[model samples]
Target: MTSHQLTAGICSRLNEPEHSDELLSSTPIVQILSVKRVGSTNGPNPIDRYRIIVSDGEHFLQSMLATQLNHFVDDGKINKNTICRLDKFTCNMVQEKRLLIVLAVTVLEQSTTKIGSPVGLQNPPGDAVASPATAQQTPAANALSTTSTAPAVSSSTTTTPAAVRGQGARSGRGPNIFPIEGLSPYQNNWTIRARVTNKSEIKTWSNQRGEGKLFNVTFMDESGEIRGTAFNMVADALYDKLEEGKVYFISKAKVNLAKKQFNNVANEYELGLEKNTEVEECRDSSNFPVVRYNFIDLAKLQDMAKDALCDVIAIVKEIGDATEFTSKFGKTSLKRELTVVDRSGFSVRLTLWAKNAEKFTHTDQPVVALKGVKVGDFGGRNLTMTSSSSLEVNPDIPESHALRGWFDAGGNSENFQSHTNAFSGGGAVAFNRAEMMSLEEVKVKELGGSDKTDYFSTKATVMHLKPENIAYPACPTQGCSKKVFDQHDGWRCEKCDRSFEKPEYRYASTTVTAGCASADPVSSRYMISMAVSDYSGQAWFQGFNDLGEVLFKRPANELVAIRDRDEAKFTKLVEDVTGQQFNFSCRAKQDTYNETTRTRYGVQKILPLDYAEEARHLMELLAAPWAQ
Candidate 1:
């Protein structure tokens, strides 16, 4: 029979002054006496620094297990009485007491029974009493309250381990909670006490990596906020327990770099919970922080990066009727547009989707506070609600109250800069809102000289209309608007490579209007080949089939039939539109036709005259310093 000898090398020599510094730089074999998890304070995501007591049968010393080594305890490989060989360590003097930091360690022997008791009683420097060898191994039951005068190796810069533990013991309220900003992938042993700010529905996915059920949670503390995900068994365990707005004491979650594309939280790191993760509700979480928003002013939204999450506080000046549409997946999606204004004297469009759109109620133009809304651009800057986003209607926050006060004090009546009409959707035409240029000034500016078209609004009376070629056959494809050739059988579109049994008819009208009575002979007539007019001047405007039909309040096919069947009726219709005042949005571009270089003005959009908006524009013009 071979006798087994359990020997502690440097662990026994730890008390010796000479061996201490030398062994601290090198690896040493020791017997583990006990290990305890100490909670962190200061940040929401706090890494737990393990207080480990080791013995060599002759002497005992205290050390801290690096957070990276948390897996050892989690795997049940570093229990009391287990023998381990430290591969790397650092010794730092904290609060005048020397503490050993275990950077790396390997199990030498696994044991469930107790090891030898404390050999000789020697207090660690600055300690009043020596740690008892027979102390209970369970951290919760027999954990000693130890304060760190200094930080552990590679610990967070803002806080120290001993201080956290000491505070917990002295205050009896537990350790200082950590904020989300303090979290990083470099540490693992941490506990986060955070309020669940946002929660996502369970989602399942399968690929080459396999399939599993997962859910996400957004949490925040005083310092910052972060997003976390739990998959498979961990998700099943914690899903029902996670309630939005509830604070929880969570530990043992793995931290990783956040995937910027998917995560909207400002934190650089996110959390992943595993089977060993601990989650306990913090009932007395009055101290826990609520989610904070760093709102971007409404005027600054246009300059921000596209798709960025935006926090904004604004007054709901206008709300569009909710519209329902079927997505490509056949899912019904509801959308509504809201015009929100802020103190910056600017207004932007916010698109609400799904429940936010359907459940929205307009009451007294309540203040709309948004967090984590996705920025969008159609014609100009717009916003969309994301799953992780939240909307507060007339929230009692300071910003909301301030906006309410501002709006009530005649703020909405002020001339607000508008970013929505800056450009038209998917068109080359840009929006011209403030300045009403004369026909000569439009040509001088060469509005549509560039690749993109320039847009301007004008008030003018229609002088004449070229009723010929007023309506044309178009391809019936939903998005394709190419002209189709009328065939005996049907209509064919070269671009679409398909023939339609029945072609959709569209109106493209070329109407001429005079800018001013005293304008130049040739350029005075503002030729709006299509689109609206106000009182400014006539410009060449062209309106497409849909817009033309909208203006005529009749379908293109019906109009075309009337034109073909009754010349007198068509003439009356054309004559009725002529000499009428209208507000028109016109697109200008230069084109060469049969050796003739001409600037063509096309009508892209038409808006019914808003007496208030026109009055505002006129007021702005009158208030201009140049005008004075």
Candidate 2:
């Protein structure tokens, strides 16, 4: 029978000096303990670092007998069984790569007592120590702890060992395939020495679906990346037991197929932590792989065309108003678009939808990171935004600092063209109540031309409304203001129906003023769309039937009558306010019949009113100008 020192060479690789002194001074015999590749040498897969296994008595016990472990088994250097001698070997920490040596010599202390205070046991004091020969066998476990204080190896070396890990095991088991790149050959039941890398504990649920929990974790071997998910029972079983960036030995998984759709995380596939899944915190995590990526440059993306999927980092230069626009998606949501520029000599439009838009409004930097954003051409040649991708703002990254510097130093112009603040020039109506005014306030007023700036405002009342008193419906199609010919089958709105089942009804929402108008002339741009709307209604009315409503229901004559009546009332309202000189602006346009050509028949003309001092009879609110 062979009498041997069970623990051998394992200490020199350790930077700890104490292990050296203890190993050299005492003599208990241990064997050669080295981890090596089992067979072929194609070198470690580029994606992963390495896979190796180490063992001692606890793992060699009873259960492993039936299986022929020789396929993966590689003999270590021969060592003679001994009593008065010591042995030593080394291993590298899987994640941090810190050198750790195991001393397999005898010690005055007993080996059966607790090794390093792993979890449950703490070292005992006093003089109940073992003889020098027995104590030397302890593998320097006394110095090990959960937190490492040793120096880490360079990232350049992410390696794996062969002995106990190979393409196939002798136990008639098929080759195990690791999901990581270059690991397909070992597709059956090959064991991988990996680091937990990242883990999320299971969250128990006792909800409507019954009771259970689901948890996940990310494991990284020297080869590449793979994610694992544990549901219900599995989550409860393992969630609390794992920690991030730790190494482990894994085996006995079903090695089923990978489904990308089931993968919601950035990872490529979803791994199931199944019933046969086996996971053990590696007692010997000698080697492992690490992965890293060279992120794309954001500054270059500024000059890239729209819809181009490129990475980008930029400071929010200016935020525009989030005008409500119906999308083809058939839902009404708020979206704000803005211009962001990098150090390049170009700028692009970024559309922030809903919460992101609102969030941008309140942000100080609005610095955003686009990992894989698609560019788009909008409003002609300008870059537009889309949601097919994702966006992040002010992430905890180094590029953030670089971008901030570029923006602060006027480097944005090099990459982007920024539009001057239009809203600041009074073009925006979002100012305070004092500075802000609605399109309706100046709705009736017509102020236009560069030289013309006789800004005046006053209220009015209803007088004699024109014959345009009837109401009408509008084209339900977005951007298509043409009236629909009633199919009589129902209210068939061809335009909106194309996008939706039903068309939106037009509310000939305009008030035929038998009411007065404001005294000041408003901007011409304001009435342009309105005139188009009105004329379009007339066109709609031509095709409109008794069964179907038109855009404008009021007859032309009726509209003229309301104008005459409303003009008179408006004069009265103005006179009541100014009292000295009262003149009002009136708006009337040829209704749009066809919106396709973007053409209009009649101009948005103004009508003046004839009024007298009798207007003083109308009741009025207190003048707000200087009431304070």
Local distance difference test, per candidate? 0.62, 0.36
| CA deviation > 4 Å runs, candidate 2 | 1-157, 160-179, 182-186, 193-212, 242-248, 264-269, 280-291, 297-408, 411-628
Model 1 per-residue lDDT tens digits across residues 1-628: 1122444555545544333334444556677887766543222123444678777666666677755577798678998888887765554333323346665688878766655565644544454343444323323212222221111222221222333334333434344333344445543444656678778767776679988898889876543467889999889989999998787777778877677667666555678888987777765555444545557798887554446566898988899999999976566678899988899988888998877898897867988888888876567777888767878888767777788888898997988887653322433232345445666677778888877656566556667676777765556565565767878877889998998766555323321111111211210111124333334444556655444554567655556667767989978987777776565556677778999877777665555567997797686567443565
The top-ranked prediction according to lDDT is 1
Q: For candidate 1, what is the TM-score?
A: 0.43
lDDT score, candidate 1, position 293: 56
For model 2 the TM-score comes to: 0.29
Q: Per-residue lDDT tens digits of candidate 2, residues 1-628?
A: 3344333323221222223334333433332222222111111111111122222222110001000111222222221211223232233222212222322323222232212211111122321333323221233321111111111112343432332233223333333323232222123434555666545434455657687778667566533445677887677777766666677666665433344343322322335777677666655455443333233443343233323344466777777887776867554667887777666555666776654555556446567775334544233223333332335667656777887877777765554543322111211111111222222434334333223222222223222212231223334443454434545464444556633223233323331212333232211111111121121122110111110121123332233344456877534432332212112222212223555322221111111233532242121112211231
List TM-scores for all candidates, in order: 0.43, 0.29
- In candidate 1, what residue range of length 10 has the lowest lDDT sum? 515-524
Model 2, residue 177: C-alpha shift (Å): 11
